[model samples]
Target: MDTELLKTFLEVSRTRHFGRAAEALYLTQSAVSFRIRQLENQLGVNLFTRHRNNIRLTAAGEKLLPYAETLMNTWQAARKEVAHTSRHNEFSIGASASLWECLLNDWLGRLYQASSNLQFEARIAQRQSLVKQLHERQLDLLITTESPKMDEFSSQLLGHFTLALYAAEPAQMKADLNYLRLEWGPDFQQHEVGLLASDDVPSLTTSSAELARQQLSPLNGCTWLPMSWAKERGNLHAVADSATLSRPLYAIWLQNSDKQTQIRDILKTSVLD
Candidate 1:
């Protein structure tokens, strides 16, 4: 299928103007119309209802919009995957901020320096984004703290992440009305460690775990950060031992793509067996 033609259709759908869509594509209006005509003829369906100054998708075009997006994403994923091994020895590994700082680089070093053909791409993304990339067949492996189980993917317990309370100085707030900051991931809000509406400490919310610490500032506040980040930047100190609030981390990859030996070895050595 002509992906560009589908893209042109989408642009026309968005702008609802032939000339504007042509300008966006760097094509003349005549060229745009011809492409649409060729598409309509090939599919035996009129994709648009053309009016004087604007265009609207016909029922037929509207029906195909979702499929077109799927195809485009699939094609892009295939292109990325194929070029991965050829242009550069490539594997994409994804994680949230916790893993990004904790162990992501160690894995990259093992993969990159061990083989001259190897290229390591590290992705910092959330669970849904990582799952989407995996669905698109764009990722070789993914590590997340969430215990997401899918029929098509294989998951193993890589390790556990333990979080602790850290502060630059002893908190000055009343013991009952304490403020504890924590990240968005399992480090803080999991049902097992519910700090959001706890009777113990009235807490603050943030989109990033790092932001949680920033909100704490020098005030009588507390936040749960990855132990690794807190230790090196000694401005913060752990107020309590962290054995209680730990969550399991998983090393995950799609089962169908599991046969890649290089990726398998790298993942085994990096996170899990």
Candidate 2:
């Protein structure tokens, strides 16, 4: 089967509208219909049921979805592997936006400076999306604050960072302060519950620390931030009685990865501090 046909099928399945799929794939509507027909003919099964504006996958199409995704990911990985030269290598790394901002950006910079022939593809996304990519072999490594509890992958502790409550006024009472919540991770949330009162609701919630800091003001709110980051900003003052939390940063990859040595070498240069 031509991979392009599978690609078109996947796109159509995702959009559920031929016109939308065509727009996304940069093809004519007729061309999109032709590809779907060709795929259905090849498989000898009706992949979709078309009823006016409603388009839905048939049973066969639903069954093929997971397999199609796996095939596409495998093909992409194979192409990248085959394209590598003797002196140059490529790797794909993923992390959350905050992780990139707080830690991995510097680590990536160090990798580029030290490894002349190494090339990297960096993806910033939420933890769930990054984990999915890692599981599908679409990412070579994932950097996250929490370790995945799966046996199919291995995680190594890169370093630790401290998060502390910071406010515009150092003496502001916790009850009177407007709280801005940052989604650090599940473990951090568990730790946070003990530090905060049950009725203390966040006025604003965000996943990016930078955004949290930008939105904070003398009269607006206080939030948990990296101790190092908060100290650098002269306007932000540490809360006197707030509890400090320590978070471990981790580098995760497939246990049976072929590029383990290279990944290890790259991680050696990571400096979270």
Candidate 3:
């Protein structure tokens, strides 16, 4: 109930000594003991086991540790959001680096003066972690080229994203036909018998599409990249013969969230139509 009492409790928990906690909080040792006693009284639980000059958390205090920390974290985040609402109306969003650099900014720019508080924090992470944070409500939206299939999470498909295969030098592809390289992913690892007639496998592979794209330029390795990223590359040239790899991307969020309106506007403006 009392945030100040909780803060003091946290300090006491930290030092495991009333006197030290009092020193940190700029309160008298007696004052610290009194506050903790008041808190224990309010909760109907003993939080500490006092021993002469030593103290340890009671069983109750141990259980409350996680909850108390959660409360403080929630309070801190709420305080931040309230402050931001008065100034920027910000929401923390997460996405992969490619989405943040190219797609997110483009949409957020026109999001509006009417909704001046509507600012987004684009947090970057790999797919699995980003999806986890989204479910945890630590992130408002996840922008990427993959559609997450979790039942609890939902999606609004923007469209299919086409990826292009490119060669380092124009001559490499023009010079050879056996240069097919596999994109690293569980499904993509298998050479579709139709796509490859050769008994030989890919020359090289890497898990990161971004890295695979980077490797495409200097080495004679074949790699695929989102068409948007690859179309502008100065050195790498697209293989017109390759099957255009198009993935359906979504501006995904947790189901039944009211924040979807704010999320929707961002998606509409940012994703390629």
lDDT-superior candidate, 1 or 3: 1
TM-score, cand. 3 vs. native: 0.57
Q: Give the candidate number with the greatest lDDT.
A: 2
Residue 32 in model 2: lDDT:
96
* Maximum-TM-score candidate: 2
Kindly give the number of clashing pairs for every candidate: 2, 0, 2
Clashing residue pairs, candidate 2? Answer: none
Model 2: per-residue Cα lDDT over 118-145, one tens digit each: 8898898888888888889889998888
- Best-to-worst lDDT order: 2, 1, 3
TM-score of each: 0.58, 0.65, 0.57
Instruction: Give candidate 1 misplaced runs (Cα > 4 Å).
Output: 1-85, 171-181, 184-209, 218-220, 240-243
Model 3, 1-273: lDDT tens digits are 987788888888989989899999999999998999999999999999998978999999999888888898899899987886658756777766655553555555665633555766768777788888988888888766667788988788877667666776674442354344533233444434444446765555543555655666456566666667666556667764566665655778988666877776666564663
Clashes in model 1: which pairs? Answer: 181-222, 181-223
Q: Which RMSD values do the candidates have, in order? A: 8.8, 10.7, 6.9
- Cα displacement (angstroms), candidate 2, residue 147, comes to 1.9
